[model samples]
Target chain A: MTDITALSEEQILEKLLGGNEIVFEQVFNKYHSSMQSVAYAIAGPIIADEVVQEAWVSALKALPKFEGRSSLKSWLIRIVANEAKTRRRKENRSVSLEAIQDSWSTDPRFSENSQWKNPSSQWHGDTPEELLSAEELKNCIEKSMLKLPENQLAALRLRDSGGLSMDELCNILEVSSSNVRVLLHRARDKVLKVIDHFQITGEC
Target chain B: MLPNCKQMAELASKNLDTPLTGMAWLKRKIHMLMCKHCSRYSDQIKLSSKTVSTLDLDLPINEDVKKNVEKTYQELHCRKDVSQ
Candidate 1:
């Protein structure tokens, strides 16, 4: 009944290398979602699962050579990102950066003068925990997230969920720092609006 | 010139990713002080970002995929053992 979380990186690496099933499952559960997000961001949803699986195979094959240059999670994410990118190229799927429209100028919440026409209402639950406590609201947010533009969704997932640096995001997404900021903002804004609407009306 | 409410909202989101400094920081501070709506919007965006970051967006790993990966892990180690 060892607590895997209490184990150091070296210890975890040792367990992984030794083919410890418990440690392996624990590590997999902890990072699978983030890996999937990175995969989805790069390779598109249709092939994201395949990309993650391939990345895992590659990672396991190369695990013995892991030098701990970065955290295990970061290393795994990098592997998945690379796998996804390669798959994207093979599929001839290019991320449509041009389709992301900056609707901020015409956003109905503001007037022609850029003043607040429909200012944000005070939310009942302020903290992240409180907001996600309701199952319906959580579903709404997830749905809204799924509807975001591909690049924006990728930027948001990589930067927020994957805990990647902005520079790393730029490198992975093949966009400039300014473009990354725009994508991140647009994605976050959509989530904010979804929450706002949910708060005002008890619907998703 | 101080940014309008719309610009303030955008800046607020950007500031969360990277802190605002210099004139941008000062402008945001002053605008937030004078505009309660923009202030609330900023707080909401921050909360949403925090929530999204903490969310477990992962669907359960498919059983087939899990089994295949596990099998691959074992085969990899078995090959290493043979090589040694």
Candidate 2:
């Protein structure tokens, strides 16, 4: 028995295409949430799981022809992204392509001179990584993430959590590089604000 | 030109996508040294981006769903092998 865990993903893909269930299952469990997040952002929560499942079926079909262009995770994510967009169209859901300019312009965090009106307090945690592992903070960040605009949420998830490149993000989101950057910044800013608020009040 | 806190925040956010260029990088750095708020904001955003990237969303696959999907794949693979 080939220890599926011992091999790299490329090796796993080789076995996976040759009918290794172990490799397939390992990769599936590892990537399902990321695939689902991409789908959820593009297709909404109602059918995100369906889209991910469908994408897997599609991935299986295309496994033989899978070229090693991108990493396996990214390739699967692209497939899920495509599936989500198609599903979105079928469901008649439209994503707004408007530039993400409004919130930044009127942000109450800064004054007319663009200086801090209310400077953020230092977080209690020593490091951001430490802060991320806290259950209360995670709850708050997750809640704040949901409240973000669809485009921003998708951009943030794909770029940050999904480990996709800016070029890939622009292609997936169908926006310019500048827009993708803005969307990501906006999304991150909201979460940062949430953490700042949480630290000061001890509430999410 | 020296950037204000709002501009600093904007630059900090954009910095995640691409590092600031020569003049822009210098201005932001100088401002960050001079202003505690902007410096804190920069640290917060950088930390935010790092932490957020590693965060797993709330969704977790159920054991039943995973088993069913694995079963379905196995069956399909078995059929393909038999047919081939």
Candidate 3:
């Protein structure tokens, strides 16, 4: 849709800081997808896109205050990261780390094949469904994720879902490696609680 | 019912990850040996996560946003506020 081919990070920064709208436009078109990946990796597709747009405005507004200490690409990405974190905070949703230890029986995401636990039925006929219905946990997880503590959710999305390493997550989160792991553990716990809570209520 | 309702229930929860283990694993083994509710709950959670993950979701960007982006740039870019 938007014609964003490519430009070195420096050139892109020049256009954006220069307030050249045309160059700005190109930069946006170029990085939007990558930004979405980061956003979605940090949150989800819905919030990712929004974070991208908001990051643009925030970066633009902050341009005058920009110091030439860092690369523009990294700086812009940090803006996006901050925006996504803020969005998650506003929503107040988060995935609980307890998912590992909690029961997701009620959440529709893990429905159907408890049979795997059935030693007798392991040899039974007609295989039951394997995966949980995404629709079932649709709004629940996303909403919960938004409510999670910013550090925890960001850790989960960036590392577990986004495939970022612990080091990378630490870099992105601007925290110590150990701190990132702690946040991730806590966040996962919260998600489990949500799923388990749903099971307790028989929603699963 | 399982021996430890809370513990088993907690263990029964693991459908959230791949090859779910740890506390959940102990929960399953304990429940399977003695408890029924926990076993069922665990089964249910696994089924739910699997079902949930399989769901096909297409969350689209707002149409108005696209229109606004295109329209604003087209209109604003075309105009320059100058001393008249």
- Top candidate when judged by TM-score against the true structure: 1
lDDT of 3 by residue, A62-106 (tens): 765777566565566567766776676677644333433323344
What TM value does model 1 have?
0.89
**What would the per-residue lDDT of candidate 2 be over residues A7-61, giving only the tens digit for each residue?**
9877887788677887777788778877878888889988887888888888888
Per-residue alpha-carbon lDDT of candidate 1 for residues A118-169, written as tens digits (9 for 90 to 100): 9878998979889888889998988887778888888888777767788888
Worst 10 residues of 1 chain A by lDDT: A96-105
What are the models' TM-scores? 0.89, 0.83, 0.40
Candidates 2 and 3 compared by TM-score, better number: 2
Residue A108 accuracy (lDDT) in model 1? 96
Candidate 1's error at A118, in angstroms?
1.1
TM accuracy, model 3: 0.40
Candidate 1 overall Cα lDDT vs. reference? 0.85
Candidate 1: the clashing residue pairs are none
Reference contact recovery of candidate 3? 0.01
State the lDDT at A50 in candidate 3: 69
Candidate number of the best DockQ: 1
Q: Is candidate 1 or candidate 2 better by TM-score?
A: 1
| Candidate 3 residue runs with Cα over 4 Å from true position | A1-10, A17-19, A98-176, A179-204, B1-81
Error of 3 at B21 (Å): 33
